[model samples]
Target chain A: MGRPLINTLRIALHLLIIRPLLRLLFGVNVVGRENLDGVDRFIMAANHNSHLDIFLLLSALPPGKTAKTHPVAARDYFEKPAWLFGIVQFLLRPIWVDRNNSGLAAIKEMQRRLDDGCSIIIFPEGTRGQAGELQDFRGGVGLIARQNPDIPVVPVYLEGPERAFPKDAAFPLPLWNHITIGPPQLIRGKSREITSALYRHLKTLADEEQAYRQRRQPEPHRPFVAAVIGIDGSGKSTLSRRVIGCFKGESCFVGDGLELFTNGEPHDAQPLTINEVRKWMGRQAKSAKNLARYKMRKLAELLLRDRLLSEVERWYRPDHIFMDGSPLLNMTAWAMLFHEEFFNAEVCSKALDILSGKDDRLKKDPIFEQFPELKALRKLNLNHLHLPDAVIFLDVDPEVSMQRIASRGEAVQAHENTEKLTKLRAAYHLVCDVLEQSRPVCRLSGDKSLEQLTQEAAAFIKKVGSGVDETD
Target chain B: MLDAEPSIYSLIVLVLLSVAQAVSLVSKGRLATPASLPVLWGLFLALAVSEWISFIAALWILAIISFCALREYLSLVDIRLEDRWGILFSYFSIPFMFYLIQIDWYGFFIVAIPVYAFLLMPVCVALGGRSRGIVFSVGALDFGLFFYVSCMGHLCYLAFFSERIAMLMIATVAAADLIHRALRNRPRALRVPLQVVVACVLFTGLAEWSAIPLNHSFALGIIIPLLVCLGRFTLKQIEDDLGIRADRLQPGRGRTIDALKSYLFIAPIVFHYLRWFLKWGAL
Candidate 1:
């Protein structure tokens, strides 16, 4: 035994060197470490793999307990190199046991340690097994437990040492050393009964820890938000709904802003759903107040859509959020085209600028002089519009898009004609270029058969989901 | 130097990999998983349109990475309250350093953060009228700038000089790190037990198998693993300082910083070594 000074140095070395190595190198996680509390004279039997099993179990003990809690070391393995054994003796203060002589001296030494009100960690497999598979217990631990029935046997499962430092590896990788200590168990039966009970208890802890690690493994990282954008008749509506339907349990359509454009319940303060945009587009230019009203409605719709997407982001965590239109890309594209057609300044852009706290554009334009109530909507600032992580443009030719629109047997909107659709297609192309600089925009031809388009879009989305740059 | 354009063999391999990954996921009953397919398709598109991904575009991607890493680093790691202005301005160094690289001002870009931004942070901290924790605050700020900004800027600089060398360094280092990770816990088929040595050998062999001239493959093979290990050590220390438990290296803030740490650590060291070797060879 060492003197008081040497004992303090060993504890210091363990605290300074061994702990940090476990921390910085292994990122060791100690669960149920507090379970060691109020327990004395216990045998902690753990399944063994790498050499780290001993230190990992020791390091996890309550502070000042490491010195008192000695590990049982084999004489042949530890005593061969005298210097290594000396260091291990000082650090671990382990009780040396000769395996060649089954004279039961080791059990008596362990009982002596237990009688002194100290604990011991024993790997009852006799020797380290291949990293993962647990070996048959040698019944020696059962003798130690039954001899002292009052002493509890603690079961611990060390998760990651097997992989981090496998038997054959030289350089150890930074694998986590997860230590899970279960509740203490007292076995007071025959030697075989005690051994079998201890093994079952250890196996249960191992299974629980293995199940926990499986749950905590790297979850497939995938982006949630994506937009499907194209011309009016390019099958974006049908394709996006199908896209949302593709995922099994968790998927949603984040509001086609044309219909159901309420961030909340349809109250008086909430504007009516201006489902027909072309009607307002034609009527807004007739009167300045009408244009202000149009801007007010479009701004509310986009802001509410932004609000809906955020609500979905917060409370409802879906696997995939399929946004029907992006205000930044699609609505802004419409605004740019509107400015070219009927007015000098686009309405949605002008209205959103005020929401962004830039009301000078609104005040400078003599159109909003009579309306102060609309300016107050700027208080609920949806300034940062939530753009999708990826965009899939269902690019179709103007004539084909018009034919698709006509095939629906619905009223042709002002911009649904071939000439207007041609200009809008060009406008979408320009917006795609600008948006591509940020997120991926896969331009799939929407003119394909419905099955083909659905298949292609779903594949693009899965690729985006399983595949690229979502980490950034 | 490796070719800037991907080879036919590599392209074929990438395509097969893309399809195989898709098939593997679908077979696992994730028939509707929509996020993974685009990643490989995106990779295919990048390689397919190699000429389209110019220096500016590639550098922007790297800059975005540096920006995200700096944000995560500043948020997670300690930057004292008194060092508010100092830490805030540390973010500006990313764009500033990348801008220098964009203009090809090698002299300014190389020293811009370490020499100049290094001086600026301490002064900024001093000007805040707080003396306590100024050293740690300023020191962390300086290291953060140099680590996230200056190191990433060198990769952009390497790309600007020769995209082939930059791509090879990136591809080889990334491939080696991945292979090393995949071999964890699994029995080593390669005779050597040192995963580091095994990964290095594979890195050099992979370069050779690609039929490209990897002149610094040996040097790169060694430095990448060493720097990556050191980088992980630093991240672990930062975790200690934060007193946070990152038990699993799961995909989130920790993983983002982990990838950035190793990849960024490899970049500046390899860049300077290549520059020095190139100069000596010319002489």
Candidate 2:
């Protein structure tokens, strides 16, 4: 009577209190809850990672099932500090089995639970392994399965829960995790057969999760590039931020154009300094000396940016990097602007031709005859720069672009009026003709809802990672 | 006074969304319709709100939709190495079309693409320094410009007729198209005919409630869905010509063209029909 009443209170607490908090803190997205429907009493076997998995598994099960779901744990670990055992009783109500014994107690406990209409959740690895890597399964779960061969064993895979609540963590941190539940299987074979089958099941789930994460999540082993390029006020930064929110990993949001000139300044400073930079640009047409000085400053800035990016690549080793704008796309498009700035028009045209891969004499870099610094910088090459694998170009009308820029409280440059934005928008499209020769460019409307734009950008990145065409 | 309650429409939409999300989760992302249904509605609601504010905002948005659709169309058709300038001019004409709209130059906006851009795009393609496949590339670019830019551009032009009429046209077409996509594989459920009826009823009801000054709205409500059906058919054929698959849209399928093609076939006729009839909102 005492034990049943205690179990009832434990179930109520786990269902009403603990589950909601775990869900809020972890953001545990349970995808296959319907698989648990019509399942009466069975063992849910998952790869062991952290204590969070226990709650996540309970959350995925039917609310009524949490009352009788018995998660199997070792006696030597849980019962040692009686206070932890007390907490475990309320949270998991786990069934304790002796690790040193031959396995009769586990089989008996599972049999008893099955007979009493209770389902079992057994960590076949017997203990938590390394964070992401799956450990070998023991035959203890197989022994329980053999004792009750008619009962089904459902396989599960937990993704990134260890990042929140590992064994050695000081406390649980709020993190997003995913749970994948596979179909149930009833093994009618020897203990070794059942164990290997269970291993294969978990392994398949792990492989599928890994492949999914490789494309959708970050993988430092396979770095790729994505860019959100548009005219001013086309919400390039907003789109980048949404994509970042969708998937948190080792990602770097890159910059280009005048943004690359910022030597480790805060991101919001770009709009603040634009007016001063535009003044310098307006004066360059009247003074060749100013033009030369600007060209040298530009070269030094590019070199410094390139060196910094190289060091970041070597040290930080991001899995993926997406830029708000592409350096190649913007610089090439702005070549027309460079034409009026005491710069040679032929070289500007040739640069556009070369960047577009039309004029194939990129290595012969004596085109900027009067600007030797720019020419020498081009010859040396930018070691860290590469073309984006995926491009999201948000096309907006210049009038609307001006409206958006004015509404935002950022400092507006001299060239931010309706006419210049119009010209700049045309230049972007003109240069995009060259970009389209290479990769799939996803051009979206800035007028779309942020949700739609973010989803499009995220899908574009996944397509790029898989090396598939955007249409596919 | 009695406290007011939320409408049943919100509850219905919420239930539909929950069912869609449940199905999407159960399928493990194989079927995209159940997953993307809510997003489609969200985009439509946003369009409905933004287009009501400023006609120029509507014009710019129309340009964006046309630009993306044209990009998808160009992606489907083959282009030679020399088609860069041709494609650039093709994309360039979209902004010009909307710019004409911004300045309320309906005559130039209407004739800009078909007359001048049609003749000039071939020249730009020839400027790629090669004549081989120039004709085909130019032909392809012109075809896309007509369907995506010219036809889709007429949507904002509907604003020149009447914002109410324009809004009604958009709501009907969007509703019917979404209903069609939602029920494409649901053979047991009423499909296109059901969508047509719902959209017609929806337009007629709204037109009656808003007290539209025109006599032809009731007639338009019935006519618009049929034109949308024809548009869907036309887009399907174009997709076929481009060798796009006939399968239902999967999760990874390109939704850019799929969402916009529903408007492409009917937009021009709606604009012109309303313009010829009401002669309203024209500058």
Best by lDDT: 2
In the range A106-131, model 2's lDDT, one tens digit per residue, is: 78877887899989999998899887
Candidate 2 Cα misplacement greater than 4 A, ranges: A19-40, A75-82, A97-117, A159-181, A209-211, A214-472, B1-283
TM-score of chain B of each: 0.73, 0.76
Residue-by-residue lDDT tens digits, candidate 1, A401-434: 7787778886554445677677677777766776
Candidate 1 chain A: worst 10 consecutive residues by lDDT? A259-268
The C-alpha lDDT values of all candidates are 0.65, 0.66
List TM-score per model, in order.
0.34, 0.35
Could you tell me which residue pairs clash in candidate 2? none
Superposed by TM-score, candidate 2 places the C-alpha of residue B83 at a distance from the truth, in angstroms, of 44
Candidate 2 lDDT tens digits, B174-251:
678677766778872466667667766776667644345435766776677777777777777766666455353321
Off by over 4 Å in 1: A212-472, B1-283
Candidate 2, residue B168: Cα displacement in angstroms equals 9.6
